[model samples]
Target: MPDEPKRIVEAFSQELHAAYHKAGVRSYEAFAARSTKINRAMHSDTGKHTFVSRSAAYKTLTGKRERLPTWDQVAQFVRVFRAEAADRGIAPDSVGTMEQWKAKYEAASARFWAAKKAAASRIPAMAAAVPAAFSDGPQTWWRAYADVVPAWSERYLNHEPLSHRITSYEPVYVPGLLQTPEYAAAVIRLGHGDEPEERIARRVELRMLRQRHLERVGERPCMWAIINEGALRDGPVGGETMRAQIRHLRSLGRHVQVQVIPAGHPAHDATDGPITLLRFPSSQFQDLVFLEHADSALYPSSEEDLAHYLHAVQKLGLAALMPDPSRTLLRRLEAEI
Candidate 1:
């Protein structure tokens, strides 16, 4: 990873730090303590147990652990499972050195299943429990994230369709979250002339870490970032690298949404400068907006602002090609070689 600070980490990290605030934790320690619960779950519940320790695990995994659920979460989970285990008197290990504990649980479960199969005369019983409801629509999902975004990050090891959709307009350069490593490092060195070597490395790592949201859990929402025609033609990373990056954007359009609004076209709301829009697909309206300037970024969520951004997106969709045409344009651009 390059040593430049990546916007992805900065964005998620800030959201996490704020989550601790609602949990009634204002201090850094309190925030970090609650935050680590996310890392803990990755190791145990999701089965990424190769992670043996946590002292510096934060550094290695972008603070995402291959850890297990906390006792509180596990306890609640067990209650739901216990009824299924039923009169068979099935019990799960509550204490463990981890490796030994896993083996014991598996062995016991296997024996329980075999014994049940042998005793056909035993009283018939319902075995499966009601599955948990994970709502599919936007409001349910966004509320779940907004109520406790960081906490959700802990429990959910996969992608999340956030409370809002972030759309950025770029006239100057590619957004850092989408930049290639070599281009990013060049940009960072240009911006942070005196940043230490170690600092740069950490920043690059953090940036790469943030990109996971794009395809990690198969749930990250679509992105619609309109580029200025000049940005496409200038080859900011030099002809070859910029061409590669442009091709990358074209490829993304296959999966998400991306369009280029020619510079000569009539200016629209996004013309003043680059801005980001994050909208939610809630059955209800819980839409949000984020705008960034040279030195500051703000989330504007009042209904008035939300409506403005949504309207902007509606216009963008109108101006941009449908997915198929967008792919064709990209292929044409790539063929130009």
Candidate 2:
């Protein structure tokens, strides 16, 4: 079976192309000429005729244009195709009767207009809702909530939900997606010491909400986190909070694949700071590398920079303990705590 069309326009184009070929019309230029002649005869009484240009016909037939042709244009093309097919002893039904073509055109036209309107309205709505800090650029919707989520992480948040797999290397703290509520609150409080308690609480709430992407019923992204053993041993939160955090990591065994790099391991790549690599399901979007810093974040756009981070993360994965052994290490740490 043929794959489904990715967009409504493509589906509508396929229908037109199939009908055009069924009528034995080969050249778009020839079809345009025929359509023009028929349109002239149909509107001759009014002395105002519609001519179909080759470029317009080509776009409509090939689905290269953003918007569908007007209804009159579509009707003219149908009449032209039917007339040509009848000349060759072809039945109108074989080339798609007017009623059949009309139904297809109306359905596709309605969907196209609805989608266009929604797209037109979304820009203003998004612009109005976004804060001034994020209004300067596109895809900065996450900036409105910058107080709760770090403003520097706007780009990362945009891609997180769309990623099919996420690989992260953290040398100082647990990856946010794997962190427990207590661990997250402690980390937030320590990082933003000047912030009020209520603000800190909201930050923790945002972190918990972000973690939900991993808990989706289906199509949840695969999470592979490699944490330095020191992060687990020398964490900000300790005592029962630390122990519960360790326990939480263990319980996530079924959902997350966790690895730990032992202390005293040889110096290696990704030692500078945390690295998060996001891979999308579709090839249309390039894989992204997110490097988080104290007050800012960087998304390396150059191919060379992306390649460097990709290699570093791969090396970190190899140096870290394997999944089963990593869980064993987590168990020992929980007991020690």
Candidate 3:
């Protein structure tokens, strides 16, 4: 059994249920029977106990059980579910195989646990330092910290959609949502310089795919971005590429608002690095702030944390040139290049 953070466990369970439904397994009993068959076949000794009861399946999915299911059990679920999905003529290609799903599970668990540990220490420090009044009452914040945003971040963007407004401050590079393909490719290569070309290409593809939310139908969000002047001047991605990127940002118009801070602007509040705040319109989803570091990423939702970032953004805005002027600056930069 994998002892993972509650969020990863919940996501793992949700994946099982989703695959189960897609596989046309309507009841826990049926799913359990199918898994048992696979398990039994694999452990053909006949003396081994391979059967899992329907109650156990239910408990696993709902997280009611005290302990998690064994690794073998999860493998059985994945195997049976994939077979069933294939039988129903649903392409199982994207769903992935048992080993791939297991890899994803392990990755998700690692990310969750890493963030959990960081939050455990950071939250207390934040609480002690910030005013009590700034503490948002009993809020749960999902945090992640890493040099590059993980692949799993796309899931959050898709699941939450554009109804969740994204506000980001980039001190080094362009925000993913506003990046050009060439610019993104250059950035990804710089970060994953040692990785294979295929890996680098996939990273660029995913980054572009994440921008679809802007064009997605129904309740589009107003994405606002604050870019440092350094990100503009710090270009080595080629003059044509930089020109296209600046023009692309200028072209986003109302869909995305871009503000540029001049090179010498002295707003050190956001100098720590990139900061992102995901604000969802739905009451069920609380606003989240994403902070990334060299080694890890944090998703802190405490009132105090959110307030600090919000103020930082406000400071950034104060120091930034407004949209029109920013575009003018971009045009100037593009022309100079």
Best by TM-score: 2
- Model 1 spans > 4 angstroms off: 1-166, 268-270, 281-285, 331-337
Query: What value of lDDT does candidate 3 attain over all alpha carbons?
Result: 0.66
Q: Residue by residue across 17-83, what tens digits does model 3's lDDT show?
A: 7777777766887786777677556545532233345655676667654223445456667777777
lDDT of each: 0.43, 0.72, 0.66
Which residue runs of candidate 2 sit more than 4 Å off their true CA positions? 1-144, 267-270
Cα distance off (Å), candidate 2, residue 333: 0.7
On the 0 to 100 scale, the lDDT of residue 37 in model 3 is 75
Which is the better candidate, 1 or 3, if ranked by lDDT? 3
The lDDT, on a scale of 0 to 1, for candidate 2 is 0.72
Q: Count the backbone clashes (under 3 Å) in each candidate.
A: 20, 0, 11
TM-score per candidate, in order?
Answer: 0.46, 0.57, 0.55
Off by over 4 Å in 3: 1-162, 268-270
- Say which candidate scores most in lDDT: 2
RMSD of 1: 22.7
Kindly list the per-residue Cα lDDT of model 2 for residues 110-142, writing each as its tens digit.
Answer: 776556445434323322433443232544535
Lowest summed lDDT across 10 adjacent residues in model 2 is found at 121-130
What is the Å distance of residue 10 in model 2 from its true position? 56
RMSD of each: 22.7, 25.2, 20.6
